[model samples]
Target: MRGYWNWLFKGDRPGLYKFFDRWFVFHVLVGASLAMLLPLSLQATASSILLPLASVTVGLSFAWSGSAQVLLQSAEIEQLSSFRVGGIEEYVYTFQTAVLCVLITLVSWCVAGLGVFDLVWPKSSIPCVYGMVCFLLFFMSSVTVRECWHVVVGAQQLLLLRYKVRMDAEKKTNS
Candidate 1:
């Protein structure tokens, strides 16, 4: 926990965004690996459905875990204003993280679809309309989750700023 706190505050310097990108890349790799290696026979339905679902599960799990980490960092930000980290930086990072999550998720679906088709059809990679719709639903889900979290963080920051100003004004009038 202390390590996370230090990373969130002390590590907020410039050039860390590159590190964040790398970190997100690692998660995407995990999702892609899962999409490639998953055995379709394990699922009840056709391999096509099972493979993409499994890959999407893996991607969402990674995104949710990373989001939790960011939420924790945001809490630490609320507590440690003296750290000089700005909310805008946090918001920007959150947006970038969300975008990465969506991209990786889409890639995972693509890889899983290709893998499934390669196994079942052995020649064609083109999926039917149903397959395309399923993938679109998964991509939309990732986007929705990412956007919702950003809105939550932004709202929290606005409320905190408002409260701080109100308290400062009250103190001035009291004095």
Candidate 2:
């Protein structure tokens, strides 16, 4: 438990990048497990109740993950100096990565709706079940969007810090 929490909120340190790389795998495994369960759980019940619960769970997961990401990025920038990697590029890369994820998910949802996933996903028992699956996809999609915003905001904060440091150094040099 201690190690899991540490991996989730890594501190500023030389090995922090390695920490993130390893924990990224852990997070995906957890997320994938949870995501798979939601669809199956929805299949067992009426969407009216299960859908809302799944939606809330998805939202909370995103918020929790996004906060964790912000904390990790903050610690990283503090330790490494965003100027070293060009904060703008980091920001753009983060944004692009997020956008790509969203587009892929959206396309997947559309394809599934058009029966593209029939070869894979089991057929929903009823129209409401289909609706429930769609809702779940949308809810999960919201998580992806928030995660991207998390990256953008995190990088922007680092960029501000980088600018302040540069200005301070200039003042000291001029003096």
Candidate 3:
């Protein structure tokens, strides 16, 4: 866990794949390998265990991506752009985050309603529960996509800073 903490929080430098960990891929393989190690009778529970394990791995990937974005914003990148786009980006991002709150509410409501349904009518919601599980499974993966979106939007901040720096240098030289 300490190793994962470091991997997520500590970045060597900036790049496209800043926090990419091969262990994420390795984990899925490892889980598969571990399943093979188990006998057939216990195999039923193995699949259940693997999904939760993969979810943990997915959560970590999100942690790294989130940490990288936080680091980028907090870094000493000057905000002296002539055309400051930070405010606009933040507005859009804020709205997008608000939408995520709605999604959370919807997912929670569905899970709860389905839970009740399953309780009231045993086995009726078995397929529905499975479907919800699959939805949640991919929902975690969507963090990776959201991370990319954040990075792309955040890159504009860095670009504006770079432009300001270069233009300032040109002005001094010409003067």
lDDT (C-alpha, whole model) for all candidates: 0.47, 0.48, 0.42
Residues 106-166, candidate 1: write the lDDT tens digits.
5545654455534653322544443443434344444434444554565466456556756
| Ranking of models by lDDT | 2, 1, 3
Candidate 3 residue-wise lDDT, 1-175, digit = tens: 1233333344453122332455445434444454344333222433444455445434543444364345345423334322444333332343234334334534433443445433543333464454344334334334334444544455555556555667887899999
Q: RMSD, model 3, all Cα superposed? A: 13.3
Question: What is candidate 3's TM-score against the reference?
Answer: 0.31
Clashing pairs in 1: none
Worst 10 residues of 3 by lDDT: 38-47
Model 2 misplaced regions, further than 4 Å:
1-20, 39-91, 119-146
Using TM-score as the measure, the top candidate is 2
Local lDDT at 15 for model 3: 26
State the local distance difference test value for candidate 3: 0.42
